[model samples]
Target: MVSLVCTLRSHQDDVNCCAFSGALLATCSADKSICVYSARDFSELPFSPLSGHGYGVHYCCFSACGQYLASCSTDATTVVWSMDTGEIEAVLEHPGRSPVRVCAFSPDSSFLVSGGSDGTIALWDFTSRTLLRTGAVTDTSIVACSFTPCAQLFITGSTYGDLRLWDLNMNHLHAEKNAHDLGVSCCQFAPQIMKGTDGCVQFRLASCGQDSLVKIWIVSLLSAAGIKMQLAHTLTGQSAPILSCAYSADGQMLVSGSVDKTVTVYQANEGVLLYTLNQHDRYVTACAFSPTAPLIATGSMDKTVNIWMLEDGSGAQGKSLPDEAASVLSSGGRKSSGHSRLMVSEWSEEDVLAWLREEGLEAVIDMFKSNNIDGEELLSLTKETLSSELHIESLGLRCKVMKKIEELKMAPVSNGTPDEYLCPITREIMKDPVIAADGYSYEREAIESWINTKSRTSPMTNLPLQTTLLTPNRTLKMAILRWTTCQ
Candidate 1:
């Protein structure tokens, strides 16, 4: 069960998209404007109502670091905005003059990709304010685009009811398949790899269409024939077209918004319906989950956005059978636990490895290096030896070590490589990089703040700037994006 925490009413027209960036939330609408609000209180920001689009804003997304926001419109332009100032940093226009329907930022925040109604896909270096490439994706409009977790691949959904996978280079089509009977409206990659039957590992993608069905795909890049995608599951319950779908950060659950004025939640792995939320008065347009919180934000054609908190089972008001009776019911009255018992009893090293990989803990060996322990040494040490050296009881030390391992499992990997594409002030990779008059490029927001609040002088050098205007560093931005793709 879930409960609505807040209902925001600011957009006069339909709210098309909603995205969360830590404590901040951004929403765009058919009112031809974008609004930013504090997620903590749902208060509109002082510098919000960013209005520059010539037509209705169709979609908006925050950069991975939340420093920049990108929105596409029916006017055939995609504008990148600095979240710090709520000002446009760059404007990207497709060469074909097609209305951009969807846009997405790569995981590294180095590239912005937009798909348009003309079936053209445009890749832009937002930091440089330059278009990197434009290619045709389909004969019909593209409605959604999403990058894989690794940022190496992207998938696009089209009005032709097809889903296509493309390489990050924007030069090759990896795979193409007819995905739905009606136009595909939304698509998203699962935040984590999924384990399927037969000990197979797969990258999962969820897509919803006007056909009123949501389909989950299993993509295998290691196939003998190269990248391949197959339908894994079809979730059929929505009576109207689904407008959006999203996976929770940990990939345990999936959520979808539909034209039926309802939102649905499902168990991601099993496709089990968990709950249905019918709080909106009109069609639900977009749905997203906070990356670090058990919160969901849904936008609707009713011109409102609602925030909901995912509840635990303790809050569920349902009766359940006793353990023995429940077990019998689940097992069809069998005395033994049957195949489920065999699966648990026969867990193997392969299964353990699979679980670790799925949990993003495959780099545990690297994580242990901070403690001056090598993989070899750790493997050689016995429980007694470890306990004696640490001066603790064997069981206590084992428990503590297990807890420490769990903590380290979520620690970020130290690649030790400095990102040259980062802003000098914020120390984050630049999402809207711009070059000032002093021949140094900084993040758009960082430089704008320096010029507007601190001083008109260049931050890099103490020289006074003759003009506060900045130029887009298109070449370096494109170079950085290409470099990131290779990485």
Candidate 2:
């Protein structure tokens, strides 16, 4: 199996936010500087370090085309930079005691949005760098905000656990209320799917605070004044407080990184936990789904950044690797027959259906695929269609299903590795602790699979492992690690 790949040593201080423009990665750091690095290689050094924020740069993002970059900071300022010239185009300064907590460019690239500590959201014209609109609700700081794909709507999450929607055209408040039990951390609008179909506008937002839970909200309400949106559904539960979340370009998958030192993927609407990325050595500060690829890039307090891909049922063997690293992705442990059955039932939806479809029974499988059909033959179908276009979702699903099938069809419910069980790497026991792209080691591929398995299938990956720092004087050690690895 190939292991996940990570480009180390990209930032100096904590990397608060990350965005991509083509092959370039724009990162904001607490060191009060923003660096643009070649996404292709970190060893090459930054293209340039644009410095200006008086304090730590809080957040940074790229324009749709990636030609421009935007960064906001505790300095109460947001600066715009042109990647081509490596120069600052605009400096946004607002009056108030609050820091410019968050800033974002509208999808259209015509405007930018910034929310501050005083609970105010400002919309600005990029060309004029002038404030166009403002929405003030709670007195608490507005922590997260995003403009919908269409650019007419904006949503903000606050320290009070409430979320508010604003109307850009009307300059009015549209919707407001608590989105979770605690302060909200991040909010994101789903990409527009189906070229022309605007069914129900859905936005997936994640909120966290003292509460370790990460709640997902689907908004459908629209403001009568001009904005349109409605609250639909929410999903909760994370090993730690979630700090950030992003949806892949396709919108079929969402990646969330948390203070919990792990990253988890959730099905947008169903709120199913597809995988638990237990790899970071410290709290994950930021995560961004690649705009055009299957990669999920994560930054953490551990002073490292990792790039991971969602795998189908294939196993750890597909992970990029060395012989010593080959076994990490395929690692597994004592089999829990009952749990295995549940996991296959839950995480195997995409796999099961694809198998049935290949067998000419596509329309007959239930949503869960739990019917008592001939299990062995059905699994073979998964292997057959894994590489074909008819199969959907990420390739990770196929890999997962294929593994479970091998276990179910060949062995009894014992801890012993089945006769067909072969490490995708060494083709041996997923022994000697497999390390994931995120940096932590897994007991076995099955263990990682179980933890990362779709919640609908495996539910839980075995009581969750305790995450502790690998170094003494963790924070200082991380700073040094970041500098060394990145340089």
RMSD, each candidate, Å? 21.6, 19.9
Query: After aligning candidate 2 to the native by TM-score, how far in Å is the CA of 118 from where it should be?
Result: 1.7
Candidate 1 lDDT over residue span 269-298, tens digit each: 777777777777789999999887888889
lDDT of every predicted structure (CA atoms): 0.73, 0.59
lDDT, candidate 1, at 143: 87
**Candidate 1: what lDDT?**
0.73
lDDT for position 215 in model 1: 90
